[model samples]
Structure formats: C-alpha cells, structure tokens
Target chain A: MAEISFPLPDLGEGLIEATVLDWLVSPGDQVERNQPLVELETSKSALELPSPQAGKVIRIHGAPGETINVGEPLVVFEVPDNTAGIVGTVPKDDAPKRRVRLSAVLDED
Target chain B: MSESTTALLEAGARDEQSVKLSMQQALNRALDEILSTDPKTVVFGEDCGQLGGVFRITDGLQAKHGESRVFDTPLAESGILGMSVGLAMAGFHPIPEVQFDGFAYPAINQIVCQIARMNYRSRGTLPMPITLRVPSFGGIRAPEHHGESLEALFAHVPGLKVVSPSDPHDAYHLLKYAASRPDPVIFMEPKSRYWQKGDVDTSDAGPLTGARIVRPGRHLTLVAWGAMVARCLQVAELAAEDGIDVEVLDLRWLKPIDAEALATSVGKTRRAVVVHEAPLTSGLGAEVAQLITQSCFDTLKAPVERVTGFDVPYPSGDLEDEYIPNIDRILLGIQRVLEYRRG
Candidate 1:
C-alpha cells in the first residue's frame, strides 16, 4: 500500500486560505479520484475540493470550521500498489496527450 | 540595382503580405509574441485563458503558451490585480486583464494604492513591472457598467502610465511596449474598435508617450484618443467641405499627457477642441484643455472647447449613442472654439 497526501490547491485569484466547512469522507472510507472530499469556504465563496488520488482515506487534517492555508496537507489516503504511480484513477496510457502550436500569423490571404 | 532602389523594392514586396488585422488580432499577436519570447511573462484574468477573454483578445494564447503560462483567474478584479502586483514583485511580468472599464472600479483600490504607488514609494528600490489591460469606451452597445470611459480615474493617480491605442497598429505595438516597461502601465483598449480593420506595419513601433497627429490641418486642432479618435477624423473630413482645416491628434498616453505635441498643434491651429466619452467634469478632455491653455496661452486665438458626455452614470445600450460624443456634437465644439474671440 502507498500513502498519498493531498494539499489544498491555491483556490486562485489571491485566495491563500480557506475554512474547512465539512468532510465528505471519514477515515477508512474509500474515495475515488476527483471525488469531493471536503467543502471549504474562502474569503467570500464556498468550494468543494476533490480528491487527487483514488484511495482509502487514512486521515483528515482539520475539523469543521478550521481554517487551512494553501499547501497544507488536507487529507491522506492509502492506495493499492497498482495505483502507486498513478495520480487519481486515470491511467497515463488512457489519457490522450495533445499539443497545440500557435503560429506568428494565424490567418493570411 | 542601386542601394536605394533595392531598399524600395524590399519595402514594396513586404507591403504586399502586410497583415490586415483588427485591434483584437493585434493584441493576440502581441501577447503571443511576449509569451513566446519571455518565460517570465504570465497572462491571467477572467476568461483570458480558455475562453480567450470576453472580447477574445487573448484567443489561442493558452493553446500556444499552455495553461501554466496563460490561464484564467476568478471573477474578482481586486484579487486579480493584487496577485499581479505580488507576481511582479517576485520577479515576474504579469499581464492582468480587468475584463472591462467598469469592472476596473472594484480593483481601483489595489491598482491605485498598491500597484501604482509601489515603485515610487519604494524609492525606486522595488519595481512593479505590471501591465494592466482594460477594454474601455462606448459604442459597442454593451450593458450598463460595461462601457464607462474611466480613463480619468486612472490618469488621476500619479506613478501610473495610462496608454490608449486609437487603432490596431498602435494596439499591437503599444501593448508590447507597455508590458516591457519597468513601471506599471494601464493599457486601455478601445473595445468598440476591436473589429475595426487596418494595415499594421509590424516593423516600426514608436515610443509609449508623445501624441500622433493622425490628420494634419492649419485651421483648428481636434484632440481625442481611443475610440473617439475615429469620430474626430470623420468630423475633420466633414469639416473640410466647409473649408475648415482641422487637425486631429491622438493623445496616446493619458497620465503623462503629451503636452508638448498638443501645445505645438494648438499653437499652429490657434483654435482647439477636445472630445471624449467621459463626463466633462474633471474628464481627461479637461486636462488636455488645461494643458493647451497653460502652454499655448499667448498663441491661443480662442478658448479651448470640450465636447464630452454629461456628468451622469453610464446608461444602457439604448441610450449610449446619445451619451457618447458623435460627429455632430464634435462639430459643435469645433464651431464654438472657432467662434470664440479674445476679450
């Protein structure tokens, strides 16, 4: 088993911290990738944080109403060995990688 | 072939493929050029990344630079501008868009108090190298709060360089110039002209300050900037039918008002008229008139006349045409200035 930790993302546009409103999952609860794990309130808006990796929840960092700064570990999860190198449940092979090149001039007559 | 002939031949060939771009496309090219050349340059604002901005000015920038370099921020104007200042202080060039002119009011506190004053207050020790992009002026028939000509508000603040491009050529070059400057700059785009097409010579980019005489004349000087510039030019052409020679000057930079160029034009023409979409009370047009009065006091043959919007909240699209100065209103200013006599 591998232990994966997720930090609160920098809910952009200068928001540095958010208060933990509620935890959707408890310790030992199985969570899927991109699943809402916690509800957080920032300066003026409420946001739901999704799980970055599919795993069994091992620990919840803060209680309800506790403010958490960005980059702080919000949750820790234990995952099977097959998901060790994988981020979330999406396999690297299945995700199509695309690149777009923009030319100096897009259109010309 | 002679050397001069060879140069002429090259110029002729280059003129054939010279791209005909609108103000929106010019801005895209400028942002793409900056992003491709400089890794430190980051662009962000509401819908600027994936959506290519509300005006589509940043179209395809994210596709070219990737989400890390070019991305969208939240709808909060204050947050976007405040973070841009921080990013600049941390040695990054931030191009933060304010979406529209009216939206800029929410960010005015951070813009005027923090970003504008940082360089001067730090005694030049710290530099806020930020370029704020704001789409301003009326005529697009946008809803309320989307078309306020609030250049005067930003121009009132010292240490801030405010620039408005009258055409696509200036939009492309001036945007790059504003981003490259060490001081903070407010790059106001005339949104109404975003679709207006013109020939953009990519090779020649001029200084940030100084006025450009779009049309030269000897009878009267007509001063305007951004969207109003086109109206002035049209009015000048119409005035010629009556044998009134009118010169039009595009005051590119607002904060550092191009007083010398304005004075020179006013001195020669002897009569001056200033036009803008903002309210006449302390509007940018008033500042230009004051400058003309101060510099060309002895040379002036008549008091400078101003044609501007009334001092009231910007109305909805239905009434915007009446609020914004048109050719008829501009002609009134010209006629009033021409009719004035020394006491």
Candidate 2:
C-alpha cells in the first residue's frame, strides 16, 4: 500500500480557501474513488469533495469548523500502487496558473 | 480584410466538406479553438463556470480550460462589464457572456459609456477588444425578459461593432473573428435558432463584416439579420409560389452596416422590405430602409416597408408568437411592397 495526501482543490470562481464544514469519512474507513470524503464551504456555496482514489483513510488533516487553504493537505489515504495517483495531484508549481496580470494591457494599448 | 482573406472565406463558406452541427455545438467548437490558441483569452459570466452557463453554451469549458480561464462571477451585470473593461484594457481578449438581452440593461451605462468609448476616450491609447456574447430575440417561448431583441440599442452606439449570425456556419466563424478583433464587438445570438443544425466549415468561412445573399431573386429584396433571416428565407420560398422572386440579404454585420452589399441588392430588386424583431420605430430596420431609399431612389418601385414587433415590451411567452415577426406577416409586408405602383 502507498500513502496519498489530498490537498484542497481549487473551488474555482476566485475562491482561494474554504472552511472544512465536515468530514464524511474517518481513519481506517474503506473508500471508493470519487466518494464524498468531506464537505467544504467556500464564499459561493457548500460542496461535497469526493475521494480521488479507492483507498483506506489513514488520517483526516482538518476537523469540522476548520478553514483550509487551497492546495494545503486535507486528507491522507493508503491505497494500492496502481491507484496511487488516480486523482493525480500536480505539484503547486505545476498547477494551471490563473490570470494574475490585469493592468499590463493598459500600458501597451 | 485583404482580398486573399476575403477569397479564402468565400471558398470556405462554399466548401461542402464542413461538418454538420447545431449552432450551439458550433459555438462550443469555436470557443474550444479560441481557448486552445490564445493563452490570454478567458470566458466568464453568471453560471458560466461550474454550471457551464444556463444555455449550456459554455458547457465543459470550465472543466477543460480549468477554472482560471473559464470561471463564473456573481449575479452583477455591472461588475461583469466593468471587470471586462479592465481585463480588455490589460490586453486580454475577454469574452463576457451577458446571460440574456434583457439582463444587459443593468450594465448598459458601462457598456455604452465605458466599453464603447475606451479607445476614443484615450485617443487611441487604449483599444478594448471585448467580445460580449448576448443570446437575444424571441420565438423560444422564453419569459418576457428572456426573449427580447435589443441589437439596435448596441448598433446605435458609434464605437461598438454589432454582429448577429443566422446559422451554425456563421455563428462559429463570426464568433472567432469577433474574438480576434482589436475593438469591441457585441455578438448577438438568436436564442430561437440556437439548436438549429447546419454545416460549419472551420477554414476561412468569410470575414465578420458584409452581408450574405442566402437566397437570390430578381423582383424584391428582403433584408434581415439573426432569427429574422430564417423567417425571411421562408418568406422568399413561399413568395416564389406567387411568382414574386425575392432576394434575401442576411446583414450579418449589423454595425459598420454592410451598406454596399445592401445597396447592391436593393438596386437590383428595385423594391425592399426590412424585417426585424425589434419595434418598428427606431429599430435597425428603419436605418436599413433609409439607406436603401437614399441609395436606390431611382431604382425603387415602391416605398420601402418594415415588418417588426410593436413598440411594446416583449410580451409573455403565450403572446410572443403574435408579437415577433413571422413568415406570414413578412410575406404580407413583401406583397404590400410588390403591389405598389408609382402614381
């Protein structure tokens, strides 16, 4: 078995962080891929996050009523080797970059 | 556009190898191309992100392009328009979707005063290349606010370019062309024909400016754009039974009004009928009719006529059929123009 850590995925619409409203799974619970592992509340709405892989929950990083930064580790799971990167977490630097420059076009136009 | 580019587009439009798809599907394909080619391009509006838009025009975009390039915003028209101004000013090609034609009023001030005047306001120092997609026109049985034709409101503004595509083919090509421009464009989609299927050639399918002669005739000219184009075509087909051959001109580019193509058609037909879903008074039809009268005064056989919606708020869904111009109403307008004789 290999350990996989799941970070909070970008909830989109400029939401950078969300509150961990509740955990749907506990340590040692068998989970299937895309199972709701936790519920998160962002500025927009409440969302249930699915498990990225079929695994055994090793640890829950945050408890209920805790806020988590996007890309920060939120859960740890032990899964079979072939299914290790099933959800496929990219490194922070390798993640798709958002538009950060809005003022640069003015000077050139 | 250069002559070569124009020739290329004509070839593309006439090419038979194009894939058949609905207007909405073609729009999706074009958006996919726009996002794939341009790193600076981004699309957003209410429910545009996770929901892929109410019409599903932006469906699968957020997932494919990632949330950064395709995302949603709050339910504020002003904020969306205001933000687009800044984003366009910053050299990004931002395609902001106005949920519907009626919903655009809340942001009209920003659209008219700011978005339209950005370049002129700065004396050419700023070029706002924003493509605002607004699904407009009636016939969908959509509620009152959802089915209005307000293209004339934008066409009246000087700095803005207005375009409405009549079919799936033009919808894909015109949208891509609008997105690539240096100035702002109001891309109006006829919601009624959103699902109508047609052949769409990705290669060089003509420039965004000028009119297209969808049907050729020698007796009279029927001028229309957007949803009315289809109705006008139907009118032309039915008018054939009466031996009144009609020429149908799709004014794809509403602003920078394809005056040359329109004049040529009116001059040939000697009689004209302008059709629109907007109210008769101050509608784009009025301008087209005036242009035809001025250019083809000697060739005219009768006074130019207009078939349009009444000057009232777009009525509820039940009455929309009676409100918006239909084929029979258009044929009547045509026959009225054809029956006229100089005293």
Evaluate every candidate with DockQ and list the scores. 0.02, 0.02
Candidate 2 C-alpha lDDT tens digits along B1-343: 9999999998766675578877877888899889999999999999887656766678778879999999999999999999999998888899999888898999999899999999999999888999999988877666657877888899999899999999999999999999999999999998777766788876658666799999999888999999889878877767776667889999999898988998899888888999999998899988998899889998788899999999999898778878988777787787677667668
lDDT of 2 at A56: 95
User: TM-score (0 to 1) of chain B, per candidate?
Assistant: 0.97, 0.95
The TM-scores of all predictions, comma-separated, are: 0.75, 0.74
Candidate 2's TM-score on the B chain: 0.95
Residue-wise C-alpha lDDT for candidate 1, range A1-109, written one tens digit per residue: 5455577888998999999999999998998889999999999799888887678999999999999999788887776533311201111221222121111211111
**Model 1 lDDT per residue over B21-58, tens place:** 87877898999999989899999999888656766677
User: Taking chain A by itself, what TM-score does each prediction score?
Assistant: 0.75, 0.73
lDDT of 2 by residue, A1-109 (tens): 4455677888899899999888899999999989999998998999999987677999888778889999788887775522211111211112222221111111111
Q: Which stretches of candidate 1 lie over 4 Å from their true place?
A: A1-109, B2-7
Question: Could you give the CAPRI-style class of model 2?
Answer: incorrect
CA error at residue B241 for candidate 1, angstroms: 0.4
Candidate 1 is graded, for docking, as: incorrect
TM-score of 2: 0.74
